[model samples]
Target: MFQQKSYQTQVSGTLYLVPTPIGNLDDMTLRSCKLLKECDLIASEDTRNTQKLLNHIDSQVPQMSLHEHNYRERVPQLIKLLKDGKTIAQVSDAGMPSISDPGHELVVACIQEQIPVVAVPGPTAGLTALIASGLTPQPHYFYGFLPRKKKKQVEELQKLADQVATLIFYESPYRVAATLEAMRMVFGGERQVVICRELTKIHEEYIRGSIDELCEYLQETVLKGECCLLVAGKLEEEPILAEYSLEDGLEMIATRVAAGTKATKAIKEVAKETGLSRQELYSAYHQEE
Candidate 1:
């Protein structure tokens, strides 16, 4: 005689990191709509903002607020629900959640609690700006925003002044003019720059020229909408070998070491700046010391 066996099944809840449209409603992915409709609950940066989106897709799934103001407090509660075996979908006002927006804190908490999180990728303003800028794409750095303080912003620009890759930065309408002026000073007036404004919206516009030229052009226009600033990399210059003695290299190495640069990095930077081989410079530096 055989007895029937009863198996206890464990339900594991999931957290879906959903991406909303950066601008146009057409940018929303079909998968995103399906996920939003099917999830047990949708956690939104703004329930009101998400309501319209849900209305568009004819979804009425339960929605809750999870934004910058309340994310810290709400994450724990959301995690507990997940623990209780309810699937949760997280969405920002626009674009990917927790990018330069909401959801990071909650996502990190979910990770710590071993909750499953999946990304439903879609529209992104940063990327859209980069691609449409028509600059070299492979090697570009995305700077989400410039420092509010002029001095700090200048310092950041100086650090990347010599970078050979294109640079992308986001700016607000109010600061767009000043940001471009700062970029012109650090990167020089001759460098090509593209200013994308109100991307994916009806008022979308692209202002392309040298930094100085663009600044002049923008001065006459009333800037409106979101901004993405793209600047070309510094022109590649041939390495100029400075007249550096072995003693000088050793002294430079000591200074860099004091500034917390590793011996290997100091050697490479010194070689690049002074135009010398790593092995030859290392050997000569040792000989002089």
Candidate 2:
């Protein structure tokens, strides 16, 4: 004899990944509230942080800590409850779970156990910043947060320097200046950039300008709150050796060298301006001289 499995319609023991507000309370969605209140268990990244939120909604759903440190140990217990037909809601301290926070491991484990996974979508700082920045909408990359070290951060920024879409990043107040400086070196001083600060809050502000301008602004103004950095993508590179006759190319080379520009860089710039091959320009300049 075998016990029959229960086929209840109310999603017995499903896992709900909830996204909390990045800064303001109004950002919370109504659906997220209903799911949180209705769920049997609430696994929070930070109990203290979640408690404040729970108080606002007037829900007494049982809460437990399930942050990065304890996610492994707590997953099996949550899975067992789901096996017993209980629904569980997982939330991080702020923003989306598993996005530079915690909860990915638990979500994976739930999938392995054949458990139902659901998401109550809400506010995300990355998306909020990108949409508000007025930058190109498509072909952007989100780098959650740059590593603390300078060399590593530079390497990461340089890799994306030539990319042709807006780039987004999250940074704390302390690191905003350094990160912007590093970005200037990689993306150049004239690249358009936007700084979104304290979004959805009273002090929220948007500063838009070239990388150099933003850097200067940061130096004069005191920064606070969570920040999102948005940078415009690099312009399309024009093909060399497509513009100008041989005489035109030679004239450009002479003008650049006369202005004290290095022969190599000047040749490359003329190649870009006149669409003439650098080698051809070099050969022509030598022949004319």
Candidate 3:
């Protein structure tokens, strides 16, 4: 394992993962501003977009594009610059670099070459919307954009169907409605969901309701801007066999089965939660049915 004492003495130039504001420029941190002005070079996902931020901060630190298309050529060059003691700051058009954006490959390259990568925390749409979405804050899972294709998206979401932590996902405005409908089909219609639109901007809006309700609401409203969708996960449950009879495990399995879970899967899950034998729980559940 490689140890990184980030702030301690080191020779190679540091790779700062700087987070740009998701929307409103006022959200940009002072520390991030200082680094942008001080760093030797800025590696941006979009030089044009990042230029706006540099102009706002009144610093013209030279920038080179390191986006998805040119990363193969850029990483080695940036690594060499860092090796020669050139402090580099990397930024995406919006939000954290390499998060549902470009920069991961270059960061991996830096890590392998033993270059220090320091993340300067700032605005990230996922966590920004999550905290305001009126859902469980701790034990949250942030799954950034899902697959664009409908079938693949549904399959991917179904894999997370059994998770109990609050789920976070990013979606484009044109496809948010479709994604919500897909979520409704896989997670059930009554699952609580919150969709934040145009976060941090003047038109920022939060629509909080069940999957079914928001799906209906979006039908009439033509939404605009980037969307952050927060879906409440399946509730966690554990049955206490001490207060109940052994047969109660069968009832628990049936409850899950009725909720669209396969009998075998439900029986196995409930047996583990209730401290009952899987074979016994399976046999009892089917016999009762």
TM-score of each: 0.77, 0.82, 0.83
Tens digit of per-residue lDDT, candidate 3, span 1-289: 6788899877999999999999999998999999999999999998998999999999879999998899999999999999999999999999899899989998899889888999998999999999999999888999999999999999999999999999999999899999999998999999899999999999999999999999999999889999999999998775564754467888887778889999989877877777788988777776776
RMSD score of candidate 3 (Å)? 6.7
Tens digits of lDDT, candidate 2, 80-198: 89889888889998888888888898888877877777777788888888888999868888888999999999999889988998998889988999999999888889999988988
lDDT of 1: 0.85
Clash number for each model: 1, 3, 0
Candidate 2: minimum summed lDDT over ten consecutive residues — where? Answer: 1-10
Best-to-worst ranking by TM-score: 3, 2, 1
Per-residue alpha-carbon lDDT of model 1 for 100-182, expressed as tens digits?
88789987887787677778778888888888888888798887888988999999999989988899888898898888888
Best by lDDT: 3
RMSD to the true structure for each prediction, in A, is 11.4, 4.9, 6.7
Q: How accurate locally, in lDDT, is each candidate?
A: 0.85, 0.85, 0.92
| Regions of model 1 farther than 4 Å from truth | 1-11, 238-289
